[model samples]
Target: MHTSEHSIMVNGIPIQEDDIEYASRSLKAASHPLRLKIMCLLSQHEMTVQDIVDHVGTSQSNVSQHLAIMRDKGLLSSHRVANRVYYCLAESRRALLQACSSLR
Candidate 1:
């Protein structure tokens, strides 16, 4: 079979090489154990860094590092309200998370 025939497609459109690279990076960011937990938590609602640390039962510094990684990869978005920074799954990624959840 020709290599072109094996190219990945999404919604009837061929995914660009750069898009594939970006998706791979984003997926990797979410694949870590702690990050995955954080994603699942944020899937329900936005949470403050402290809230995440509490639920995940980890140090604030560790949770903050995971949050930074996911945020940098665009899997998450955050906003500040007064003194608190809240995080939620990026709008574009919500459907992806929902779909993943259904697989279990």
Candidate 2:
């Protein structure tokens, strides 16, 4: 990463306004313990809401709410198959997640 008079480079890529906003949102979304746990779980593999509830030991509604929040923040993405929804971390935010994990 390098810095210019007006721009910052990240891994040889120039950082832009949208990139800054996205990183900030992703960090905020993963700041919560439950949400961070969810990210850790999903980092391993995509999981259904029931699976997340079981792993997080939280109520389904609570897990669903967190999932929705993360999805809205673009830190997570979901797809439906049949009656179940599966979620995984967005590829763009995986590096942020790795940084968060190292802080643990």
- Return the top candidate by lDDT: 1
Question: Over the full model, what C-alpha lDDT does candidate 1 score relative to the true structure?
Answer: 0.91
Question: What is the clash tally of candidate 2?
Answer: 0
What are the per-residue Cα lDDT tens digits for candidate 1 across 1-104?
A: 43878888888988778888998898888889899899999999999999999999999999999999999999999999999999999998887688778875
TM-score of each: 0.88, 0.89
For model 2, the local distance difference test gives: 0.89
Question: At residue 1, what lDDT does model 2 achieve?
Answer: 48
The lDDT for every candidate, in the order shown, is 0.91, 0.89
Superposed Cα deviation of residue 22, candidate 1 (Å): 0.5
